[model samples]
Target: MMAPRNIAPIGYSGGSAPRSGPSGTLGADNRLTTYANTTRRRVDTILELFFADKARRADSDRLPPDIVGALHAHIFAGGSRTRATLCALGWQSNGGQERLPGAVLRAAASLELHHAGVVAYNDLIENQEPRRGIVPLRRMMEFRYVSESLGKQSAGLLGLLTLAWSDELFHGARLTARQRCAAIPVLAEMRADVIYGQLLALTGMDCDLGDVDLALRIVRYKTVGYRYEHPLQLGASLAGANPDIRRTLSAYARPLGEASQLCADLRSVFGNPLTREQPRPEDLQRSRTTVLFNIAAAVADADQRAELLTLTANPDLDATGAQRCREIIETTGAAAETVRMVAQRRALALQALEATPIPMPAAEMLRVLARRVTANIPSSCCLGRGTS
Candidate 1:
């Protein structure tokens, strides 16, 4: 495999405290506080709108009876809402009105639905046993009233259909026909690219390492571009962001997305400050090709590094094995290195925001808010609930 790229981490240098808000009181940073509060409110509204009874009214007619049960179960079940949060914040930053058009709201909620669908499929493939603190997908379907195969099939198909619905929702926007048409291809491309990233991570193919260029390409393609930039772009698209503003968001999203994903990488491997429920951080067990993983594996001594590799490569390793691997990684100091990297990425994200024309105070507030999310792993935020 080619060596991995070395982009900076996405978080601050401070310890795993998830509540690292700005030093000043909420009084001083009220604009940021307001923005965050508004963002959270909007995120909630978006979810309610998307999953509301009205949202489900069309389902029975739209989906076959066999799959509707599974589809309804996953959609109504609470989920990360990360993409919706991203879109809401991005829309606000782009000057979207207090009551964003229904189209934009639909788009934002659909982004989350697609994300959930992806997770459901991923769990099935990876044989993961838990999601949002619930029993595994297999158990959810089969253990209660049906067979495991029926449950698996239901979970898998529901996820797939939800993904398709996410696309249709985007296409159904109220924007000008021309604008909507233009946005569809861009959104579709971003959605497809995320799946590609998942495939690359799952298959463990040999990737090129010598080219620093490839690393950015991988990160941009697999991580940054899809995670933040695209969602921001979609929000920008909704608000009709000018070319310049769009370009600026593109630049800003890279570091922010990297930091966010890096934090996830940390939780997956070292420990999640946001939600500590993972039996094991999925990244290490899966040997995800995160930038931090590349650095840690490369930097460790031969014996330790080999041990890390061996542990991850074992497909049969269960939760017990995941715990053992976490021990190996911690002993090798890889966990600390991962923390350091998150700090670096956080800095990069802030720097990108600084260079943009966004008002300095507002930009600072956004940075602080980003920090808040990063800091709140396993503690304030359970994978299933609000931030700690």
Candidate 2:
């Protein structure tokens, strides 16, 4: 194996390197903020134009106006825009120039739409009620149905529509043939990976205790591949980065993505004030099988295991039961193990970053993003008003 490179530590306080693009000599946070704000403005513009176009043909369009409203609401709802940010970072890694290319921005914005569609569908499948502190798109539409079957069908159609819009935006971007060829297949792969991962997770809903491999497999495909790997690759591809650069980015992305998912799992149980979406205990209530639960099951005593199984088995876990489940997970040492795993994975990601040949600023941005994704938020923050 090639030894890792000796890149400067991210956010290093030593003499700063010259800045790239319009970011100037700004620190990691400032650079990220600049990118995020710019991308957000562009995304808002895209959505507004889309809605405006629809309004012009409201009568001719087959979709209901309310559905459009719901989609708009979903877009405006709280999100960290992590994938999009990573996309921009990937472009920067390849020496992308000033003013933030329009093609890159459009492609990045498309990621958010794709994510929205996936989440809507996932919420329906998991029977999750609230998303971003409001009723999910499917549930909102389900209210119109006289029967569960009809409601599900309608919601499924809406989800499909959301995905179609995502594609429309993705292909609508102006790109060279080379960029398009590089990016389109990756986008297709991302969608397929997420769908497969979801299917795998659903299949493992009744997974046996201590099924750590299955849990990680699900994470690799569902969270890591779709959320981290694909977006980074997509951005790099759009920048016309070579295969070696893309491979290096993936190396950094893999461990970071796994760590990110682990942190999310931890936050779901321990609570994070920084996260403005999803209720605490939401994971427990949904009985979403996660690595945490699998580890807890593996370490718990027989009686404790039985207790956990029973709690998770409950279709509607009450607050009291939720509390007990937390206690069981904590007392069993699974929580501690998860924390350890998070740290380990973060270290691995950073190590990969140090070895990457990407530009220093891009590498630093990835480092900053890694910390942002994995760090625990202060308790004083609200659960519905922070980065996603």
Question: Which pairs clash inside model 2?
Answer: 80-388, 276-383, 276-384, 276-385
Relative to the unseen true structure, what is the C-alpha lDDT of residue 352 in candidate 2, on a scale of 0 to 100? Answer: 80
Best by lDDT: 2
Point to the candidate with the largest TM-score.
2
lDDT of candidate 2 over 78-163, digit per residue (tens): 55566777788788778886345887788888898889888878878788767445677666676766576777777788778878
lDDT of 1 by residue, 1-388 (tens): 1111221122332233333354573433455445444444554565455445434565656744434444545554543354555665566666666455767777776776677677677677666775544455556767644687787887777677778777766666667775575467667878778777667655543553123233334565666665577777777777666777677777777766766765666566655433344545455655446654565555557876777677777767677767776665555555565555556767777666755565444455566656654563333112211111
For model 2, what is the error of residue 257's alpha carbon versus the real structure, in angstroms, after optimal superposition?
A: 0.9
lDDT of the candidates, in the order given: 0.59, 0.73
Name the TM-score of candidate 2: 0.86
Candidate 1 Cα misplacement greater than 4 A, ranges: 1-66, 136-138, 144-150, 205-223, 273-283, 315-324, 331-333, 359-365, 376-388
